[model samples]
Target: MEVILARPRGFCAGVNRAINVVNKALEVYQPPVYVLHEIVHNTHVIRELEEKGAVFVEQLEDIPKGSIAIFSAHGVSQAVKERANELGLRTINATCPLVSKVHRRVSLLNKINYDVVVIGHKGHPEVEGTCGHASGSVHVVSSPDEVQCLQVNTPSRVGYVTQTTLSIDDTAEMLKALRRRFPEISAPSRTDICFATSNRQTAVRELSKAVDLILVVGSKNSSNSNRLREVAQKNNIPAHLIDHAGEIERGWLDKARRIGITAGASAPEHLVTELVAWLRENYKVRTVREMDGVDETICFQLPPI
Candidate 1:
């Protein structure tokens, strides 16, 4: 069996910054530093942080009064930040700068009296946080089909933003549909999907061409990771999204000569190495190569101390 790895697969700049935020908070703050959500979506990453004295909470009220609270990389609604302030929590925003950019775009649309149309899955934390930036009309649509039934005050006064972790192709189709329906609709000067999401998907697409099966290492709830699996499957290649090497099933590898391995933006590179080690131990892996892809040097600065 031959193994192909996707370059720029794990830990994008935002994820690195978010994780570093938590780690730095743990080092600077008192024990039990609280995080609004999973710092990023990987269980292993969260587990490691937990071992280092970080506590993950879903609600601001769950955190102790006057405790240090860090926002997740998915970002949070402005309301969450206000509530944390109300509770006297010392907050460090670990929101990915890219996600924050979307929030700012939504805020700008609201300021201009334009009804915002968010292209993302409803109820997703990022989508919810982004929509929260708009105090006026905001619509969330996951697909191009949803655009047909979307209601707005005026099609000409509408603007759109996207979840940072969305599939590039899916978002493009939705954008095309939106533009077709509302010729006057406006969008950010650049696409809202982050560099990491786009680069990883591109690498996976390249991997699919040379491999018989693809294994995506990421948690189920991780949006970018799930998108990687979807990108492969959409190409009619067999793919599986797993949280770790333990989830890999030998049966899935039957009749597979070449396998491609990639991880979601939030996943750790160590997981990929672990998966490769497992493959080498179990299968007659003859060659391991990394497909050439984008070289990501982007890094986000940590929140002020």
Candidate 2:
């Protein structure tokens, strides 16, 4: 069987920077390093870091006073930062700079007397953080249907931003619907979708069309990873979102002679290597054609340790 692997499929620069923040902090500060959330959404990465003395906590209250605490790359609400500060946790902001850019745009819009709308999943940490930027004006709408039903404080004066990780086509469709409904609506001068997300999805869209089945390696909670599977499924191709090779179902490959594989930004390369090796050893997989596409060198500097 032929397997097509997309180049630049895993570990985007933001994810790398976030993971490195935790790693470097642990190295410099020693054990008992506490992270406010999973540095990134990959299961293996979290397990590995946890083994190395990094403690993951969902709330600032769980961290000891006077200890260092990291905000995940997912970003956090203003309230979270305030609470962490109140608790005496030496806060390290590892939020992706791209995500922070969106926040800044929306903040500017709010400051200029515009009611803001956000295109993203409700309750996502990033969305919550973004909404916190404008509690008086910001609104969250996830779908075109929701946009149709949305009620803004003012009809003609509105702006919007989106989560860093969302399906590009889906968000475009929603944005189009919103624009159609509100002709005078204004949007950010820039796009909020991160570069890594756009590139990965673009690569996978092409990869999906060439293979009978596609595998997206990522945790279920990972928004970008889930969108990869949705992209493949939207093309009428069978797709699986799995954490590792063990999660792969042999039944899906019964009729497929070729498969495409890609991983989310938070996923590491080792899972991809292991999965491909498994297919090669047991499923007669051979002749991998590497589809190298985008070039990404984006990196964020960690806050001083």
Candidate 3:
């Protein structure tokens, strides 16, 4: 058995920055640093941070007044910011710059009286945060079918932004439908899907051709992680999204000659290392190689603590 790892697979610039934000906060402040949501979606990352005294909370109200509250990399809505201020919490904005760009785009569109549309899964923290930026007509459409059912205030005056972690092909399909329905629709100058998400998916697309089965190491809730699995499945390759190696099913690997391994943006590289170790020990894997792909050099600056 052989294992092929995807290049640019784990810990993108934004995730790196976000994790550093939490770590820097821990260094500067006392224990119990409040985070609005999971700093990043990886289960292992969150567990480690929790061990270091980061408190993840769903609501701002749960945080004590005047305490330090750090926003997750997923970003937060304008209302969330206001509420945080109302509670007298010392807040640190750890939102990924790319996600913040989407917020600014939607906010500007709404200010200009354009009915905004967000291309993302409804109820996702990032999507909800992006939607919250728009006070006027805004809609969340996840599919090409949903685009047809959109009821914007003015169909002619619509603008759109997408979640940073969406599947590029899927987002393109939605964009096609949106353009057909609203001929004059406006869009950002650049694609909203972040560079890391695009690079990882492209790497997976390349991996699908070489491997019999793809194993994506990431938490189920990680959007970019899920997209990586989808990219493999779309290529007719069997794929599984697992948080770690323990979840791997022996039956799934029985017939595979070469296995592909990739981790999501938020997943730690050590998880991928452990996965390779497991395959080596149990499957008697003789070769482990990394596929040639993008060498991501981009790094986001960490927010001040």
Q: After superposition, how far is residue 225 of candidate 2 from its true place, in Å?
A: 0.5
Tens-digit lDDT track for model 3 on 168-260? 999999999999999999989999999999999999999999999999999999999999999999999999999989999899999999999
Q: How close is candidate 2 to the true structure, as a TM-score?
A: 0.97
Q: Looking at model 2, report the run of 10 residues with the lowest lDDT sum.
A: 129-138
Model 3 misplaced stretches (Cα beyond 4 Å) = none
Q: Which candidate is the best by lDDT?
A: 3
**Ranking under lDDT, best-scoring first?**
3, 1, 2
* Tens digit per residue, CA lDDT, model 1, 1-305: 99999987999999999999988888887579999988899999999999999999988999999899999999998888899999999999999999999999999899889999999999888998888788889999998889999989987899999999999999889989999999999879998999899999999999999999999999999999999999999998999999999998889999999999999998999999999999999989999999898899888888895
Q: Quantify all predictions' global Cα lDDT against the true fold.
A: 0.92, 0.89, 0.94
Residue 261, candidate 2: alpha-carbon lDDT: 95
C-alpha TM-scores of all predictions: 0.99, 0.97, 0.99
The local lDDT score (0 to 100) that residue 220 gets in candidate 1 is: 96
For residues 45-142, write the lDDT of model 2, one tens digit per residue. Answer: 99999999999998789999999899999888788888888988898888888888887877888888888989999988889888877746888999
Q: How accurate is candidate 3 locally (lDDT)?
A: 0.94
